[model samples]
Target chain A: MRRVVITGAGTINALGRDVATTLEAMREGRCGISDLKMRDLERLAIRIGGQVHDYVPEDRWNRQQIALYDRFTQFALIAAEEAIQQSGLSFTGKLAARSGVVLGTAGGGLSTSDENYRTVYEEGKNRVHPFIVPKLMNNAAASHVSMEHNLKGPTFTVATACASSNHAMGQAFHMIRSGMSDVMLTGGSEAMLCFGGLKAWEGLRVMSKDACRPFSLNRNGMVQGEGAAMFVFEDYDHAKARGAEILAEVIGFAMTSDAADIVMPSKQGAARAIQGAMTDAQLNSDDVGYINAHGTGTAANDKTECAAVADVFGHHADDLMISSTKSMHGHLIGGTGAVELLACIMALRDGVIAPTIGYEEPDPECALDVVPNEARDAKVDVVLSNAFAFGGLNAVLALRKFA
Target chain B: MTVRDKVIAIIAEQAVLEPSDVTGDSSLEDLGIDSMGLVESIFAIEEAFDISVPFNANDPSESDFDISSVDAIVAAVEKLKAEQA
Candidate 1:
């Protein structure tokens, strides 16, 4: 099989609007979770999230594009523009036919549905927007990205909840490695911060009203976040031929399902995915110096993920540095893994490990070098990104620094 | 029904047992109520009493609303009602 490498990366999350600013924020260990700004905020039990502020949609898109795009779709298109621009490869002729886009989004156009539902039920209106269906579709972002970039190959969207991005990116990697595609714009986006979304999540009662402190004994629960992150996955040979700037190499990917619980995570299932990824990459436990944990700040997820890491790495678990960027960016739901993968690439390329901020007290159950509160400088060659979603879906990706 | 009786009724319904079979000292687990059941019971109690119980399913023990026993839940609900009043 041929190898795959990341040629370009772009993101517009709570941390910052692009890759450079996002990595800079990660280096400083900033907290992006704060009081959410939305309509009817007083009705929510949990009002804080990693919301992107100071954004103007009119500044980026025209009237017609705005009509066709939802909030999540807009985020994806913006990030995709930056990614495709950075790659410096314009899809044309044969390249256009061989390239495509695959994105992950659990709540595509959720805000649109929420608003229309309110219009019909609460306001007793018979009419809604004409483009509501197209705007709110789950694959709207992928379709738009493909159309914008002239990609005519295998384009689709994956919706595995929190693990959606990892699964989508994993598919992209496989497609490139197997020569099904030469270049794929792959990532994820989510904008589920609407009133209906928050109300539905509040019923589950796993949300924290204050802060998301992952791996900390005083942790309450996860805080929701909204945004997107996109990447360009290209064939190694094709990229090297064009003299592309490679960010990192996608070495391995593994996905597993617990088939046990719907909400609660399983240690055995998560451990198997991590182990499977390492085996696929042909790397030893000692070679992996960093891990981006799927630490949701909930009591169950943090401890469960720690146990899985310990089970897979054994004694070397103590030497590995693991941190939850969710502590800063909050849980992005389907789009979370894509944003967290940026931290992995940053670790492998820049040697700066992102910190798990808001770490007040270390939990005995999650005893490891969490890199608490402060970013650390660690030279790491290989890293892993873990995404364990609800419904027992687990996806792990292993990456190596391209030499 | 009194606050205690209402609390007992809710817990009993979640456990799928008659209200008479439930007692104030009975724990949720002892009554065969799991985590999801506990969450439903909390919702029922909140709807019946019209009071928001400061409970988080992630860490029930860390919550201010005591869910240790039926008696504890009733006491916490009564206190919340009085404070809200």
Candidate 2:
């Protein structure tokens, strides 16, 4: 099996418009959750969300294309553009045909749905927008990304709720490992900060009232965030042969389904994913220096995830630096795992662990070195990124510093 | 004021436009009212008149009742109110 390594990564979240700014904010323990300023959100029960405020549609897209593409796909295009630029891998070569794109998204073009619903309901108009179907589908983001970059190999979107991006990355890893594709653009995008999107989450009743405080005793619920993160993954030898800048090698990946509950998270599922990844990587628990937790600041997710970490790492769990980037970026839902994976890769390369902001008064159940509220400088050799979704879908990816 | 005036007022308020901007024959799209705004307006109409609007966006033209224009909205609201009474 060929080894898979990330050559470049890009992200746009509530924290910042690009990867460098976002990572710098994370290192400084910044929180992006703020008062919601979206249209007609004043009357809603949940008024706060991690909205991407600076994003504007590129001039390259026509008016019709703009109308058809959702905010999530717009984010994906921008991030993928940056990733492709940074990877320095030109598709002009033989890499064009062998490359693919696999994106993850839970709520795609929902904002468009919200808009279409209003046009029909309040107006009593029979003339529906022509771009409704193209705008609202989950696969639209991946399709747009592929169209933008002309990636010919296996292109699709993975929809595993919160674990969507991790699943996408895991699939990309396997594809490269199996020699099915030489390069793949993979990640997730989510733009569920709209009024209708928040209303749907309100029905679930797990949204936080104040700021998100992951693993904190006073943590209320998860905060929804919107963003996209993408990575250019290529085979180790393929990248090295082309003199590509290798960011981090993906050693192993595993995904597990918790046939347990629809909304409730499970420790068994989380532990199995971590263990499975470790086994696949042929590494011991002690080899993992840091863990990017799936801490959604909700009570169930934090406790269950902590227990899973303890179960997988045992005594080493206490010493391991565990943190949730969600505390800063808010929960990106489908895009969470993809952005969190970047944090892992950066930590492995930079030797600085990003802080889990809003970690105050940690619950005894979640007693780990959450790297509380302040970034720590350490020599991180191996890192693990975990994502557990609503349906007990758990995915984990293990990455090691490229030797 | 007539029901037509009240309906125009409601549409104007809900769509965040001037009352004069919403003519009796004006399309909702021309008034800058999207689907989400339409839903909000429906909720507002329900609360204001204390009558349920048995309408679905998916099946907007199912009933003889329609709300495309100020006159139609007022007529629909009045008919629904009379039925409840």
Candidate 3:
């Protein structure tokens, strides 16, 4: 099998607008959850979310681009611009035909759907916009990314709720390793902070009204976040041949389904995915030094994730550092795993373990060594990022420091 | 419509049966109603009575509304309607 390496990374999330700013925010343990600024706030019982209040689309795109690009697709383009620029590889000729773009998002164009629905239903309109179908499709982001970057091979999208990005990136890695593509633009984006989006989630009753406190005794629930993270996954030889800078090596990836519950997380299922990733990477428990947890700040996820990690690592679990960036950046849902992958890169590249902020008191159920409230400096060669979504889908990725 | 009659009518519609064929003791599973049917039944009931049901699909045991049997669901709905009154 061929080796896959991440050549460049870019992100615009609740934490920061770029990879550097995001890593710095993690280093400082900054909390991004605040008062949501979306429409119809009074109707929502959950008032707070991890919204990107600083994002102004007009600053980046003009009237024409804005009309064609939905908010989610806009995020994908912005992140892709930084990632493609950082990679320093111009896609043309053979490279253009072989490269691909795969993105993940549960709500592709929720803002568009929400706006049009209100116009037709509430306003009692007889007609709708002409570009509604293209803007609201699940593959819209991926399609636009491919067109923008001249990538013409194997473009698609994934929509597995919270696990979407991990699954997307995992498929990208497999594609490069199997010689289907030499380079791929892979990550995720989400823009579900509209009134309709929040209202639907409100019915689920799994959201925190005030804050996100992952792995804490006083934790209420997960907080919704919106943004995107894009990365360039290239074949190891292709990157090295061009003298492209290597960020981290994608060594292993595994996905598993519980097939048990629709909403509730399964510990055994999560454990299998964790173990599978480690096994696929040919690394033992001792080699891994850090874990970016799936911790959604809900009562069920934190406890279940901690149990799964403990079960997978055994005695090594206590020594390895685990933290949830969600407590700082909030849960991005479909786009979450892509953003959390930034944490693993930070650990493997900078030896910095991002802290799980908002931790007040430790619960007995989650007794692992969670770096809480403060970032820690340590030597980390291997790291794992976990994403367990709703509907019992779990995906885990293992990364190793490039030698 | 009475709670029992309305509830049975929704369930029977999902099951493709006459309302008279459905009994208060009939379990949702026995009536061949799946989760999708259950959600549709709940929506139909909500629209029919304009009453919200406090059902937790994740943990039905903890929810105030009962979906164990048709009779239990009727009792729960009547209680919610009374509380609203």
Candidate 4:
């Protein structure tokens, strides 16, 4: 099996438009959740979300291209551009055909769906817009990324709710490790901050009235956010031979499904995933130094995840530093795992652990050292990023500093 | 004030349009109200009148009811408010 490492990473989140700014905000424990300011939404009970403010499409894409792409796909393209540029891997020769793209998203083209539904029903129009189907499909982001970058290898989109990005990245790692591809761009993007998406989330009854407070006794619920995060993965020898700067090595990955409930999480499910990754990497529980938790700030998720960590690591959970970047960026749903994976890679590289920003009062149920409310400097070697989604999907990625 | 005048004012405010721009027969599309704008309008009406709207803003097809015009929205709002009472 070939060793796979991340050569580049890029992100656009509520904190900032790029990876550096986003990472700085996370280190500082900044909370991005604020009152939503759409033209409407004057009367909704929950009015706050992690909305991407002042993002002008004109800055990233032309008017014609913007009209063809949904907000989610646009984010994917912009992030991919940054990752590809940073990777310094030229797709000019045979490498072009061997490269692939995989993306994850929960609400692809939801804004487009809302727009066309209104046009057809309220306007008495017989036909929908020509770009409606292309824009609204779940695979739109992957398809757009492949087309934009001319990647010809495996291309698809994973749809595991919040775990979508972790699953996507895990699959990419497997593909490269198996020599199926030399280069792959894998990540997740989401743009569900529109009024219609907000209304649907309102029905779920898990939206926070205030900002998301992960692992806090007064935590309400998760805050919705929008963004994209991508990583360029390549075989170790290929990256080294090309003089590419390796970001971090993907040591192990595991995915499992609870299969017991749709929304409720299971500690057993999460424990199995962590164990599986450890077995794959041939590492003990004590090998991991930091954990990027799914930590959605919902009462059930935080407790369940904490229990899972305790079960898998035993007493080691107290010594290991664990945190949720979601406290700063809000929950990016499908994009959360991908963005959080970057945090893991950076923590392993920079020897710094980002904090769970909104934690105040500690919950006895979640007694692990969460690196609460402030960044901590630590020499991290192995880092794990955990993501659990609706329908019991759980995915975990283990990363290590490049040797 | 009549219910009609109040409904028009609510629609204008919710849709972010001038009061004079909305007419009883003017379709919401013509008045530039999208689905999100319409859902917000419904929410505003429910809050203003202290009632619950029966229509599911999430599932428009299930409702089978249209609020495309000022008169139609007013009728829907009034019907929901009366039923709540």
Best by TM-score: 1
Across all candidates, the chain A TM-score values are 0.99, 0.98, 0.99, 0.98
By DockQ, the candidates rank as 1, 3, 4, 2
- The number of clashing residue pairs in each candidate reads 0, 7, 0, 0
Q: Which 10 successive residues of model 2 chain A have the least lDDT summed?
A: A202-211
lDDT at A373, model 3: 95
* lDDT tens readout by residue for model 3, B26-73: 889999987657767877877777887765443355657788899998
Better candidate by DockQ, 1 or 2? 1
* DockQ metric, candidate 2: 0.02
C-alpha displacement of A15 in model 1, angstroms? 0.8
Q: Which digits, one per residue and each the tens of the lDDT, describe model 2 over residues A289-332?
A: 99999989877789999999999899999889999989888889
DockQ versus reference, model 3? 0.12
Off by over 4 Å in 1: none
The CAPRI quality class of candidate 3 comes to incorrect
Interface RMSD, prediction 3: 4.3
User: In model 3, which residue pairs have backbone atoms overlapping below 3 Å?
Assistant: none
- For model 2, the stretches where C-alpha displacement exceeds 4 angstroms are A58-60, B1-85
Q: Going through the candidates in order, what is chain B's TM-score?
A: 0.97, 0.82, 0.90, 0.79
CA-based DockQ, model 4: 0.03
Name the regions of candidate 3 deviating beyond 4 angstroms: B1-85
Q: Candidate 4 residues B1-85, lDDT tens each?
A: 5667777887787668788888999877777876556667766766778876555443353454557677887787677667778
